[model samples]
Target: MDSPNTLAVRIEPMTVDDLPQVLEIERVAFPSPWSARAYEYELRYNDMAHYFVAWLDAWALRHPANDGVIGWLRRWVRPAPTVGAPLMVGYVGYWLMAGEAHVSTIAVRPEHRGHSYGELLLAHTLQDAARHGAHVATLEVRVSNTAAQQLYLKYGFDKVGMRKAYYSDNDEDALIMTTPPLNSGQYQEKLRRLQIALTMQLNTQMGRKLSLVSRTGA
Candidate 1:
């Protein structure tokens, strides 16, 4: 079961100042975490790279005077620099290429796992992609990540193919997954159900404790 603290977790957008924490989580989560230089390159060169973080927000009430910022998630429409104030908690990184939205990465902090943050992030990403004219979304997952595979399946992504020796660190094959055409009524119904499930899970985790305004104020 998810801890109450995890239920109260928040997502936010990544910022240049968040590199340290972001890299820390990356290092712990992946054997081949992208290097600081690579992240720098993404921030600089990539016309379409987004990054985000997720963290517990219990401190919000304890440190009310401090910034209420918590975790984040990031997604990019282009490789350009992110604009405006950052408000990410867990990010779904994807690329909109040739009319398809390709999810490149999704990660949550270890302490915040199994709380549906990833699903929330993906749902938000899909919505954004649809709004931006993407008709489909694709992603590749490590064969060993059964949990992630199940999550993707719950989101209506299906295994369409695979790539041999796709992961560099272990040379593991990757399972390529794709969603049904986004315009289909069936797909929309599935997405709606998933979104409802996600919201309910989040609310349950939070104990449906308070109004959004009160919670945010805390």
Candidate 2:
């Protein structure tokens, strides 16, 4: 944890308003990025789609502490009025339909990648998919992305197959991975334990003394 007072990072349903930040990350992280119009269509017209954004809490960015009377006024009289938008650090998207969930994409800003915010997003996605009656979840990651493969394996996803030339930009093969049935007790218990550890990591790294909101709005 860099600072004990750092605000919580939150994941919430992605809306049209989040496209700009989301696209910015996509462009930087991948050779080919989905366009804003594609994202808008997913948000507005794709009934099977589920997407989310992770943003930092707005408090400290808007009210960086002062050492004198103004700081005193903020602490004792009234909290400094929050200004500006909370930083959007990451996002994830997937599709759920007919008992299956397919992860479409996920990325964290390069600067924010090490803080476990990406793990937080992945955990939330699986849990949310299960709630919506998805029995299994799957995704395809570039064969070269060992870090991502390890992360997925940590959560019970197994490499089940391969997709030849799955990535359009470079014709890179993708490892197809799938989880055991999400509704099964074994899988659920594993996810529950992981969720606990993930929450602790997020709290430890991002600070969650307060302002941890519900999944929908966080």
Per-model clash counts, in order, read: 27, 0
Model 2 clash pairs are none
Q: Give the runs in model 1 whose Cα sits over 4 Å from its true position.
A: 1-12, 59-89, 209-218
Best by lDDT: 2
Model-by-model lDDT, in order?
0.65, 0.81
Q: Which parts of model 2 have CA positions greater than 4 angstroms off?
A: 1-6, 59-84, 206-211
Query: Candidate 2: deviation at residue 49, Å?
Result: 0.4
Task: Output the TM-score of candidate 2.
Answer: 0.82
lDDT of 2 by residue, 30-62 (tens): 899999999999999999999988877655434
| lDDT, candidate 1, 58-142, per-residue tens | 4322222222333221112112123322223344566778889899878776644676767777776776666667799999999
Error of 1 at 36 (Å): 2.2
